[model samples]
Target: MEKLEEQIAHLTRAVDDLSDIVARQEGEIVTLNRRVHMLMQREGEREASSGGAVVLGDEKPPHY
Candidate 1:
């Protein structure tokens, strides 16, 4: 019974540690998602203002 209690305690501690790690990673993911959204919006606006040019190499822009 004591060994069982010890094992349960260790499992609980491990689960709590994993939960904290998941929470921290969730926050980081949210931050990274926001940054990616902002970058995408900026790139879209830049492309629109540039007349929808192709992103591929050697392709002339629509203005050509």
Candidate 2:
């Protein structure tokens, strides 16, 4: 019975540690998600102002 109690205590400690880690990671993820959202919004506005040009090539010389 004492051994069982010791095992349970060990498992409980591990669970608590993991829970704290997960909570911290979740907070960081939320922050990163917000930053990405803001950047995407800015990019969208820039694209809209640029008339949504899809061409991606260098301009040819006047002789061409």
User: Which prediction has the highest lDDT against the true structure?
Assistant: 1
> Which candidate's TM-score is highest?
1
Compute each candidate's TM-score over C-alphas: 0.82, 0.76
**TM-score of decoy 2:** 0.76
Least well predicted 10-residue stretch by lDDT in candidate 2: 53-62
RMSD (Cα, Å) for all candidates, in order, is 4.3, 4.4
Task: Judge candidate 1 at residue 2 and give its lDDT.
Answer: 100
List, residue by residue over 1-64, the lDDT tens digit for candidate 2. Answer: 9999999999999999999999999999999999999999998998799897753565566697
> How many clashing residue pairs appear in each of the predictions shown?
0, 0
Q: Which regions of candidate 1 fall more than 4 Å away from where they truly are? A: 56-64
Clashes of 1: 0
How does model 2 fare in lDDT?
Answer: 0.92
- Deviation of model 1 at 43, angstroms: 0.6
